[model samples]
Target: MVAIWLDGRMRPSTAASVLVISARQVQRLLRRYRESGAGAIRHGLRGRPSNNRIDCGVRDYALAIVRETYADFGPTLAAEKLAERHGLTVSSETLRKWMIDDGLWKNRAQRRNFHPPRLRREHCGELVQIDGSDHRWFEDRSPACTLLVFIDDATGQLMQMRFVPSESTFSYFEALEGYLKDHGRPAAFYSDKHSIFRVSKTEARTGHGMTQFGRALAELNIEILCANSSQAKGRVERANRTLQDRLVKELRLAGISDRAEANAWLPTFIEQHNAHFARVPARPKNLHRPVNEPASRLRDILCWRDERYVGNNLTVSYERKRLILEDSDLARSAVGHYVETYAFADGRVDLRWKGVSLPYRMFDKDQQRVTHAAIADNKRLSEVLAYAMEMQKAAPPKMPRTGKQRTRYEPTGLRSPGPKSLLAKRAERRVAEAAAQAVE
Candidate 1:
């Protein structure tokens, strides 16, 4: 109170007189106020220069290198990149602080101290976060790949990860099938608003109302919830960050190069990783629910789609041989009409005509014409011939032979190189002529 009173404008002598404390105390308080200002009252470290801070130019250089090529890098690795590539002398902590202040970096798996309104799902298999991380997974050894990660929200366990060429409906189908086989289907899948899961298709103001993946999930009775923002489903995104870091290192150490080896090694790696990081039981027993679908139905649930044209004989030729739709309404009505054929991964085909179910018999599936087959032979052959003629016309004219060279030389076919030594060749030719004339 005396210190504050002195600071507020009470005369030093008057403050000492009021408090009965020595004037030296008032002098010390005033000295501290003068030296440290209001910050002194807060206690602990405040605005002091950190011993671990990176030098400004080196920090800026590190920032530039990160921005140019490695912006997604976390601090520790970014620091190593700085040391190796940019020659910046700095620790990870220093780089972290500099980047955090600059808003160029964040700790992805940071733990918050406060509680939120929405708690996690009660069981491990209740909700799973699914996302694809497109990464240079094998670093220099392989081209980039997409890792389709399925992580449980409650237990933070990575259920399955599939390395794919790209993120597509079929890729997810493959991933989901793998996930189901490993841990069974979760009650609901939480994911981003990617077109695969949450596409809104419109056709001249009329809605298709179903994407391929959405339809697949619907058929499987799996509910999908799309998060509006990244933060809403931070778990999988965080997992993507972790996997991108750890998986890259793991692959490099294991000498795994590219998609083939990485994929082959993924199962073993996942087992080891999950063993180390998988969370302990919160409620004792495992919460993963078994798949409810019959094995036959599950087979048809995951597959690609094809389209077929019905013939005049009330039969559809699929996979080569004629698939006679016997007494079939689809065969009778869909004559001269194109019908859709959904080809499951397990090779089962489902045919539908104008949204009506069509019973199909895939007698010779190998001979069935592809739904959207390429151009026919005659058309393609004509196009090739026309292209050849056009290429001949467009090509540059060849340089003509000069004076003496034109008489004996052919231009296009194979030819021997002209002799470098004219005298040696002339003597040899003269000797040959003398021998021929002598024989004659």
Candidate 2:
């Protein structure tokens, strides 16, 4: 443009339009080009120091203080401490450069581990990401707990939120039950490879590769997808991070220190959060289908279900409890067969055979004792330890089976029956004598 303008082939206005610069600026460039040739295109202040440069003494003093005191601090924090503590005001970027030059800090390029970004589902309820975040939600005021978060992939809206003691199958069942009630049934749920969603063990002996929660979803005709990585279900993971910050502060402000209160308050926070962060879906269609089952039936679907084989005595052992079925025709028929056991959230257990509920009584064993090899997941470790401690306090100190009372078995100083055969013969004689006396 300058050459054309200088040759008078193009007007100054035309050159200005082509270069997207003012006509006067174009004229100035043309004048400089004519006088000094192409070398004039370089900036005049290329090698000059900035006019607002700090004094050498001040720069030295700031760097000295930072090295002596805030050596491990980042540029931004070091700058803040310099201004606050020493009255030395310096921008973070300026300090960053100076620290880099002084070898106190190194300017490192941020290297991001690239992941293939997944596009959001077009319709709402097409995919909902579910996760449980175990955190100190109440800070130091209360014990840490897990928060189950349900978020939509399409709109990024929080579909449901619940605070639970831990990430267990039962906890997930309760949260999912609430979600199904509110939002009906979604096409599918996206989740991490938690055992509640997927059977992690390849050689799992029970449920035929399906988890209890997975079975519930299958029964409801809903699909559940297990993500290979946290980034695959990034929506719920990111929401957990945000809630850890915002929701924790909100709970503190509301003076909520327990799961119950926080759970009751979560609905309002979810609404506000969705209002701020939710996006409009690409396709403005709702893919959620209404559940046709009643609430009672839905609850039945959400509970822990397993099959226990009834013994000859019409009893089934479950969770260290002997379920003694009532003596009836149904109970007799159920013996030597597998009866389905439904354990509900509210501590109710029902025994059913062929869809007929058989009345039963629970004979509890020492289920409360934490066995030597009891395995608890990382998320539930706190709760498990707490309960173990409580049980330890209440239960008697365990005695070794082989520990002797000194050296030998001391006589208990009480009468003992000689033998089972003799006792049975005496009982028969007594009954026969009673029958003869009655006839007389």
Candidate 3:
């Protein structure tokens, strides 16, 4: 309307009044209409391709890489791999659409149920949520293993991650050592009721009513809080889920099929992940306290400790293995006294009496079997069984006896039963004679 009125030679002031706009706006409209006609008023770049659009060649290259290398990866991870490995940068959503169109990924119709949000801690290291996630991290390239994750409750930063054969006290101790070395001693560790952190049985024989891990943390002046439910420690639980998705693919792409390789690569991954996802804490102060103990003390505290009573011969039994203390005045005095044994994760065992090292020789009384099924965790169960089968196959077969096979009641010894065997023969002869007379 303003254009027509202006074309009819209406004054700029009159057009502005009719259009409820300033005369400057009316003159600007007139200029636009005269310069490019009516259609030029629309956006100039509407019908053109986006300047940021991915090129066809790049898209085809990325798609080809995805199809060959990341066929099982989700869109987000596939996009990341395309950018990181192939140098083909594309938006995750664009990659998702491409994957959906190419039949490489599926969009699920199911909706995710909401989980009520929990407030984060006020300061970093106030509460470190820890857990172990067992998965096929290397897929079929190697055996499955457990990843120990320690995440801060406040910042959601992964404080430490270590790959282990299983979730055991030794594994947690190793991870905790790394965490303390990196971030100091946290105020408290939040975790699930795994036997490593909590005693499952009420009648358990822990003298201090604490697990080995709990004892270690207590000695370090750090508290351990066991969550009653998985939701209570949801931070680490959710992190485990994300890691199972992202970290697995990362290991696969890096060709990391073993725990050593994964552990070596974890620090870099942690830095990148935290840089991307860690949040600023409500308070800037770090809640972690510097450890006051010496490195040796820390090592002592982090090991598996148990008390054993020395027998009359200065012998002690641990894990079905016997140890003979060297005969000295002090060692002889230690006989019938209780001694502490510290078993380290690296297979080092130390015996101490009143904080003094005791020299001893180990005698393995019980033979160790190839398979430790009872002690193996879910991650190593299959491998343990497979190894046991192999060991059985490689074992030598027993020889068949002609006529010297012993009966169940027969005794085999270095000395022969001379007098005893003759007395037993006389008794058998007398009994047979009495039976024959009775029959006649």
Best by the lDDT measure: 2
Sorting all predicted structures by TM-score, with the top scorer first, yields 2, 3, 1
Model 1, residue 383: displacement in angstroms? 27
- Over 305-379, each residue of candidate 2 has an lDDT whose tens digit, in order, gives 999999999999988788889999988988899999899888788889999999988787566578779999888
Candidate 3 lDDT: 0.86
lDDT of 3 by residue, 1-440 (tens): 55776668788888789889899987777778889888766666799998888788877887889899999999999888888987777889999988888888888853345557789999998999999888888899997778999999999999999998778788899999999898899999999887788877879765778999999998889999999889889999999999999998988888788889789899999999999999999999998999888989999999999999999988998877899999888888788889999999887789999888999998774444563346765655666787677767777644567775565456556686456577798999999999999999
TM-score of 2: 0.66
Model 2 scores a C-alpha lDDT of 0.90
The local distance difference test score of model 1 is: 0.75
In candidate 1, list every pair of residues with a backbone clash: 318-368, 319-364, 319-365, 319-367, 319-368, 320-367, 320-368
Query: Relative to the unseen true structure, what is the Cα RMSD of model 2?
Result: 18.7
TM-score for each predicted model, relative to the true structure: 0.49, 0.66, 0.62
- Could you give the C-alpha RMSD of every candidate to the true structure, in order shown? 21.6, 18.7, 18.8
Per-prediction tally of clashes = 7, 0, 0
Query: Which digits, one per residue and each the tens of the lDDT, describe model 1 over residues 1-440?
Result: 54557557687778888868788877776677778886664535557767765467776877788788878888889889888987776788888888887887876555344434346666778889999888788887766768899888887888888887677677789888888888876788998887777764555363356677877788877888999778788888888999989989998999988676777789998888888888854565565667888876776667765567788876776656667665666468888887877776555667777766677565554432222344533313433345456655766545666777646855788677776598888999999999999999
Order the candidates by lDDT, highest first.
Answer: 2, 3, 1
